[model samples]
Target: MHWITTTHIAVTWMLVGLIWVVQILVYPQFSRVAARDFPEYHFAHCFRIALIVVPQMFVEAATAVWLLHEGIRATPFLISAGLILVVWLSTAVFQAPTHIRLMRKFDASLIHHVTLTNWIRTLAWTARGFLVSFALS
Candidate 1:
């Protein structure tokens, strides 16, 4: 496999692991944060996670586009690209705004919504991880 493909695979799997942790462990625990502390904690969480997640997301997306440009028209590659799109769209359409609301105030319903909606990313990345492995094979 090409180096770009390897990098893509690595970044993709890293995101897969990260999303699962966020979904299962991190988000679920948000409601437990003390009311007075929630805003500060949410703000810090956004800043720190953005530092890690944004760059990796960019790299993963760039490599996916590069693979398509390089003539990787195989089903696995195409499906993986589609899954990447799903993750991005879900983040933009659902997750990001929800996080913004959380930053303003801790609503138990919003916490639940984020936790529930995050399955879109969690499952997409999980499927992408498997699809990329198939692409390699």
Candidate 2:
């Protein structure tokens, strides 16, 4: 397999793993943060998690596009790219706003929304990762 494919698979799995952590551990933990302390906690959470998440997402998306650009026009590659788009859009439209709202205070509804809506991303990235893994093979 080519290096681009290798990078794509690696980054996709990284993102898949990260989303699961955020979904299972981090988001659920938000409920446990004290209400008074939550604003600071949420801000810190966003800032720190961004440090880990953003670059991996960027590399995954860019490398997927690069693979498509290089003429790997298979169903799986196209499907993986499409899933990446869904993951990005869900994060932007749904997840980010929920987190921003969460920063104000720990609203249980907002926390629930963030936790639930994140399934879109978590599952999407997993599918993308699985698809890309096959593409690597």
Q: Give the top-scoring candidate (lDDT).
A: 1
Q: Quote the positional error of residue 104 for candidate 2 in Å.
A: 1.1
The lowest-lDDT stretch of 10 consecutive residues in candidate 2 is: 128-137
For residues 103-132, could you state the per-residue lDDT of candidate 1 as single tens digits? 998899999999999999999999999998
User: How does candidate 2 fare on TM-score?
Assistant: 0.97
* Residue range 1-137, candidate 2, lDDT tens digits: 89988889998888888899999999999889889999999999999999999999889888977988899877887898999889989989999998888888879999999899999999999998888887667
What's the distance in Å from true for residue 43, model 2?
0.7
- How many pairs collide in each candidate, listed in order? 0, 0
Task: Give the poorly placed runs of model 2, Cα more than 4 Å off.
Answer: none
